[model samples]
Target: MPAEAGISGGSCPDFIFPPAETPASDGMTHPRNPLAAPVPLFYTCPMLTTLAIRDVVLIEALDLEFGPGLGTLTGETGAGKSILLDSLGLALGTRADSGLVRTGAAQAMVSAGFDLPADHPAFALLAENGFDADPGEALVIRRVVKADGGSRAFVNDQPASAATLRELGGMLVEIHGQHDDRGLINPRGHRALLDAFGRLDVAGVAAAHAAWRTAEDALEAARTDIENAARDREWLDHAVEELNRFGPEPGEEATLAAERADMQKGAKLADDLVAVGAHLDGSDGGLAALRQAARRLDRIAPEHPLLADALAALDRAVIEASEAEDKLAAAAEAMRFDPARLETVETRLFELRALARKHRVDPDALADLRDELAARLDRIEAGDAGLARLEAAARDARAAYLTLAEALSEARRAAAVRLDAAVATELAPLKLDAARFRTVVETLPESGWSPAGRDRVEFEIATNPGAPFAPLMKIASGGELSRFILALKVALAEQGSATTMIFDEIDRGVGGAVASAIGERLKRLASGAQLLVVTHSPQVAARGASHWLIAKSHDGLVTRTGVRPLGADERQEEIARMLSGAEITAEARAQAMRLLEAA
Candidate 1:
């Protein structure tokens, strides 16, 4: 065996020996002959390669290496086997107890290492929790518990929460005890297990459910809008009618104001034109007097040169005066105002300004407001038809969801029947022949519907023929419960199973043929994965590819628990010890040899 606690290439080591040429249905390699070929360092399955502990209960400092296949640990009643399991649980983020620390120790620490396949679920979980893990790399989880009961956790040497460790541990290993609440024993996981066994796809049902929710939401929103519009129906109709009658146009306010200003200016200039018309009215006016003086000057202009200059000036003045009079007459004609037209323009401008104020908008935006009000009124009028369409769509979506859910429920029922039969076949071998196993698939009410469909799945068992079926946890005997769990595990095989499994004294109450049967099934299970069995049964220990003897030794001052890895001869001696009470006899050795050979 390698000194380090991890995977390495070598010949079939004492830790892992498979029987001659057996094909595994779970898609893991089983060596054709243990002595002939070298065992590769990497296996398709994930493996718990190492567990290191310090100052935890009776264990002081311990480092143990592991490998693939069934590895058995055996010890006396007070040999600290429970301590080993507790240490592993601490590393796996179980509750931290200060009492677990050793005497005079400040803290207890445990670290667990695993070699995983590229596609293991733990890698994805690490990523989800903000840790980076690569394919083909070993994962390490460490936990430290202070004597005061505080704890800290690390994943791959990076700081993490205990919750994260717990989640990752769930994916890496499953520890099955008589009263275990996790894995197959938990009712919550039974549905997923059934689906995995049947390879059922739930994506279609989930999509249908989501579609139904979206359609219902849309229908509800449309109904709310219609109800709100109905509340304002009278106001909208009145507003639309008022706007339509007024017929406000873009820029109409500015246009009306400009026209009114021009009319008022013309009216003011009418008085001024009348005053100017009086100055050029007749012969006594300025234009007639200038014409008379110009005629007189024209007659005297030929008598003297001075007289001619005067006549030219007088003629120029008369011509300019006549042009001014003509312009004044035209101004009077253009400035002519009618009171009726001014009054009409003023009234229209007032109405436009009043409408703009009532609507709280500029005149230019009044036209857009009119259109919006009209649209609201139209929607209120068509509210019943729109609601009908939306209701139909919602109904269709609900129908589709029901159809898919019904199909899924049917498939689950069929899968449940097959699973029950499979579990039945395994029960007899585990010495539970008289017990009955059942997979219950019950339909839930509509209120209980979900993306997983409207069905509830649970695993129930009856220990006796006429007994009522009850949950596994409620079984009267721990040994029977453990046996039932083993049977179920064997039947399910690799379906929804963790890569590594630990059975804590699963063979506690049985021996001889039954113990051998449990050992055989465990070995078969280990063919595709890793298993660590804590056993008192010599038969089960004899079947181990590797054996560990957990012993508690005391020096003068302190007692400590340690694990010793056994070679082939050492394993045989341990099995002999287990067979014979306190002393090893010749017959026990021979029997141990027979068991080993049979394995």
Candidate 2:
């Protein structure tokens, strides 16, 4: 065995074993040759490559490297073993409180590095957020907690936010703390986990839901328009008919008013033009009178020089009067016989003016109003048909969505049956043989429906026979909850992301065979992914493929915490110490030896 006696404690080695080559298997089964005796297989999975923590709580400075398989952290109470987990949680972006910083320390820093498989989702998440990460290198996560309760986070040496750290950390490591708020305890995640377990078509359901929502929106809009149109149907119908009868055109009012003005002015100018024509061209008018005077002056001019000048002036007056007579005749003709036409124009103009006044708009706007009213009336008529069509579409969309959701729900229920059975097997081994694990699948009301589906999935348990099941969070005692969490984790280990799993003393209240059972399950879980367990049970600690010891040391001035990997000898000593406390007896050492050999 690699963990032999007499090897001193130091940093964990950078070596890991590969997974056994075999057919697919679940937590309860391991594949092997049919005729061969059961042989345990050691395998490596994604691991926390290293952790460098400084000035965090009780720890002053620490650097640790972790190998694959179950790496157990063992120490006496108050040895600051938990500070390692606390620092790791801090680096994973947990909320930093002021007390996490050591006394007189300016700030505490924790940095963790992970070695992951090429296809780990953390790589995808990092790429999606434009962060630099290489699968070939260790992915680094760092956090700084100041004495004043302020904090900062970084990823791969690039500045990042706490949220980013939390999100990415969740994909890389799952820390199942004693608190309910951490890990898979939250009910909100239950449905998704169930879906993942069942391999249900989540994207299909989401698409169907989106389609249904779109249909609902369209239906609501159509209904609103129809309702509004119904309220104005009567007025709109009347308006449409009236405007159609009026047959108003763009700029018609201005055109008709102009025509009316021309007709009235022509009528007023007719008499004046006729009177001027009579004065210029009638027998007693200016032209004839000028002609008579010119003839008399011409006859006297031959006899007198003064009469010659007068004859020339009379001839010019006769020509001027003739030109004036022709212009007056033209003007009189243009103004004549338009009184009946003027009456027609005035009637039409008045009608248009009245229409404009009734509609409370300019005459120029009449055509636009007519078209608008016509369109509205059309919609009012079409709304009934449109509303019916949209309603049908909405119904179809809802039915389609429900079909998929119902199918997914059925699949989840089936998966829950298997999950419950699988976890039931784990419970008995963990010393909860009488406890019942149940996955409740209940349909949500319409008001509670969401894109995920209409079913509410919750994990519940009954700790005793014939007891009604309640939510896991309400289990009351922390020990039972932790055990229940452990069972659930073991059952679903094959379904989640490629993350390093951490169980913080989940085997706190159990021992002997129960602790050994937990250890066996933890080893099984490690076959799929790396596992870090903080445990006080020698049975559990002995099962570890690798082990670490956390201890406190003081130089008389200040106290500090430290962690070091236990070699073969150190592991046995630690396990013996765990079995018998500070004073180790020969029986305890022998038992620890037997436990290591069994592991």
Candidate achieving the largest lDDT:
1
lDDT of 1 by residue, 1-599 (tens): 01221122232122322123222334443332222232332235678999999999889999999998999999898999999998998889888898999988999999999988787778878888789787768899999999987998999899998888888888888898766788888898898777665556677888999999889998887777668768988787788899999999998988878777766777888877776777776867877788888888888789999999898888888888788888877755554577898799889889988988999999889899999878666767778897788889899999999998998887788666656766775777788999998889999998988888888999999999899999877888878888888777766555566858899999988888899999988877676668899999998998888999999999988999999899888888889999997999999999999999999
Compared with the true structure, the alpha-carbon lDDT of candidate 1 equals 0.81
Summarize candidate 2's per-residue lDDT along 1-599 as a digit string, tens digits.
11211011222222222112221224443222122221221222567889998898778888998887788998889999778888888888878887999999999999999876576677888898899888878889999988987888889998888889888877778887677465677798888777665546678889999999999999897677667768988887888888888788888888888777756677778777767767767678778888988887777798987789888887888877777777666655555547778788788889988998999999889889898777666767896687789989999999999998898787777667666765776788888998988899999998887888889999999998998898887786676777888788766653544348888888878887899988887876675567899898888898888998999988888888889998998888888898887799889889999999998
Q: Score residue 44 of candidate 2 by CA lDDT.
A: 25
27: Cα error in model 1, Å: 31
What's the CA error at residue 318 for candidate 2, in Å?
71
For model 2, what is the error of residue 289's alpha carbon versus the real structure, in angstroms, after optimal superposition? Answer: 73
